[model samples]
Target chain A: MKWLRKDLEKYVQAKEYVDTVIIPVQMFQVVDENQLEKDSFDSEVLAIFANEIEKELSGRVMLAPAYTYVKGADLGREAERLNEWIKHLKQQPFKHIFVLTLDMQWKKSEASLDANLLWLPGLKPTNLQSQEAVQVIRGQIEQISELIRSYW
Target chain B: MAAGLLAPMIRFAIDPVLQSQEKSGDLVNVNLSVDDITDTPQRVDWEVQQVDGWYESNINRTAWVYKDENGEIVALSPICTHLGCFVSWEGSEDYPNEFYCPCHDGRYYKDGTNVPGTPPLRPLDVYEHAVENGMLYLGEPKPREGA
Candidate 1:
């Protein structure tokens, strides 16, 4: 939260304007039913985390509903899915959409997840830190602010 | 003295005539302005930005910039040390983050590091860059040492 506050402060100082935020939640089912039961705890934590992000970015930013499932899709198909979501958000008249991917698995294939988001119109992509995804999210917010300023 | 003087006069007289006959065509000098050579980035940026997908074409025989999602930044030469041809970036949609050469399908990172599977023994070349005010300046392309 300290890092998030710091990044937000920097964005405000930089006078960056953010319109919409896209938060993607990890929704994968484990093989173990016991693990699945425990995974509910993870989901609850993710829900709370999303709530915090929405609350923090409110008024200044609109929150897109979380992307619930993204586990078993080809990279191209995943990109298409993300594009659909961005199209949906564009209809809302939002100028910028921030996408948050909660992907813990760090593989070369997984890196394409962000690249897929780049295919979306006006969607600026960034990664979430394992320990502090919120801070990384805020840094992207600042970056988007800078991009908007460049246009003005 | 007589023979030497005669030889010199004969050679001087015939040299120009022979040279004129040997000339293939008229040689013309071309003067290029600095602006003409350097103003291409703005034009290329606009043109490439409008295009879709990755382009592996060469510019000025020195370097080619892969126009992916990062806009119009110039990339190093595509010629692999092991073999030569253009290298494509993000060739396989599955591994879309790396630069790949189609010949042997040599792979490289965005920063030009070569991957293990490829025949490329070296990394890609990097172009020098400078920005003056709003304009971007790219330096001459050079081969990547140990690449």
Candidate 2:
């Protein structure tokens, strides 16, 4: 992970480029009772993954702290948690912030729920096998970049 | 005798200051030593020997690195030509490789060129680089044409 950070700086220095940070949020599904014997996703595991990502993006990109929630759980609680997270991010020095839902169902469609959340920012509703999710994420990045440019 | 002695004393007192000022005009040569660059799956940091003006000034040099849709390493400058604000790598969660500026919302590609219809009519700057003895040396950055 440290090496990744170093590589990022190298590339930035070598090419003289700047960029916003990308943070991925993952929602883990609890294993069924019959499948409990198999490996299951947990918040701790997600934290470890987030930590690794933070290391890789240390200097080149800002890694937002990861928030883990249960899949198919209480929508109200999920929305509350997300709103709180966005509020917290607003205090940071980041130029732009994003929220990757990580295959969760919060059911809140309106972007204005939390006026401070910066317009739902971006969402990664699912982690399906198709690369559609990646493309969606990419498109959003392009749009945001354009928006930033319009001001310049 | 007192006046003659005072004249010699005045000349002696001024000679060293004049000599010191002349010496100050000499040019000092600076040699910058290059250091090795290491890479990892996430981020990258490096250390190199100091050079002239390196410690006293903020260097505006920056670079963008990301894997394209094909997963190739794409590196470019992060400077926005519109106002020179450093652009972020990811503006929205949906766009990972797109360069974004929060100051004015300027947008650029992974290659550091501005997107059409955007405020930035030019691309980001680029730094010259070379690998020597397993070390990477970055030269000064040059603004992209029309940027």
Candidate 3:
């Protein structure tokens, strides 16, 4: 489900049926001049993958808006903030909260974070419209969707 | 004072008669072509602008239209008789050529009759339909007897 007014209305009525929330934790920081291209490409790939996962299991899953952070931001504070978001979402009594991210920095702060952090390997900047890129993304979506279902 | 109190109660009792009554429906014109529908049930989604006095709304409608055994036009409601979830036309390995509801694995035959042992005890509802100049127009959905 999208993060829009219309969808939020539907979510309110079907909150119990939709128990899982997928949050894309995107990192917008570029450490150096050379890292700029990679950071943007990685974020795009994460969005593509997360969007596909949401589409596959849309009936029971809610796609929360992405949580973005700079590379040099305080990890401890960000973790706390993320937890606050999760706590608020729990008012809906969500059973599963997954933070899908491409940033490995979250790995160190995972212990304090309330949501489950799933860090995936970042991909090189490739043409997303190409058949190879789409095929790879689709494969990952199928695997991730199956993993999420296993939790239920 | 007693007549004043009794008069309000009497007015409440006769309120139905004093109020004007009317039956109205927002029948929409769906642009689906009748020729496109065949023995194979096809899923069609249409939208209609519903107007009720002062309130105006647009709603989406779904139906599976096809020809029955005698080649009569049939438009079946896409809703599952169990819980109102949208059902899709089955073209799969398990349930081939039937209406399948993913919510509870409910299945309905080509004739909109629910298969035995499914959660849906009643057959799928049928849509009131009419054809004009090759276009199929759908109306209110009414319940049908259980298969």
lDDT order of candidates, top first: 3, 2, 1
Report how closely model 3 matches the true complex, as a DockQ value: 0.05
State residue A110's C-alpha deviation in candidate 2, in Å: 4.3
Restricting to chain A, the TM-score for each candidate equals 0.50, 0.43, 0.94
Candidate 3 stretches with Cα past 4 Å from truth are B1-147
Quality class of the docking in candidate 1, CAPRI style: incorrect
Give the clashing residue pairs of candidate 3, or none: none
Which of the two, 2 or 3, has more DockQ?
Answer: 3
Clashes of 2: 44
What 10-residue stretch in candidate 2 chain B is worst by lDDT?
B36-45
| Backbone atom clashes (below 3 Å) for every candidate | 5, 44, 0
Per-residue lDDT of candidate 1, residues A3-79 (tens digit): 25644564354333344444544556666576565455555545544444443334334445566663454645655
- Measure candidate 2: CA RMSD: 16.2
Give the per-residue lDDT digits (tens) of candidate 1, residues B1-147.
899879857866865333332331321111222233331221121111122247653222334444335443443654544444445456546567676654345687766778866666678876544333434344434567553
Model 1 segments beyond 4 Å from truth?
A: A1-18, A105-152, B1-147
TM-score against truth, every candidate: 0.30, 0.33, 0.56
Candidate 1: C-alpha lDDT: 0.46
- Estimate, for each residue in A34-140, the C-alpha lDDT of model 2 and write its tens digit: 53222143333334334433332333344455556555566666667767766764564434544433242432532533521212233333452236753554455
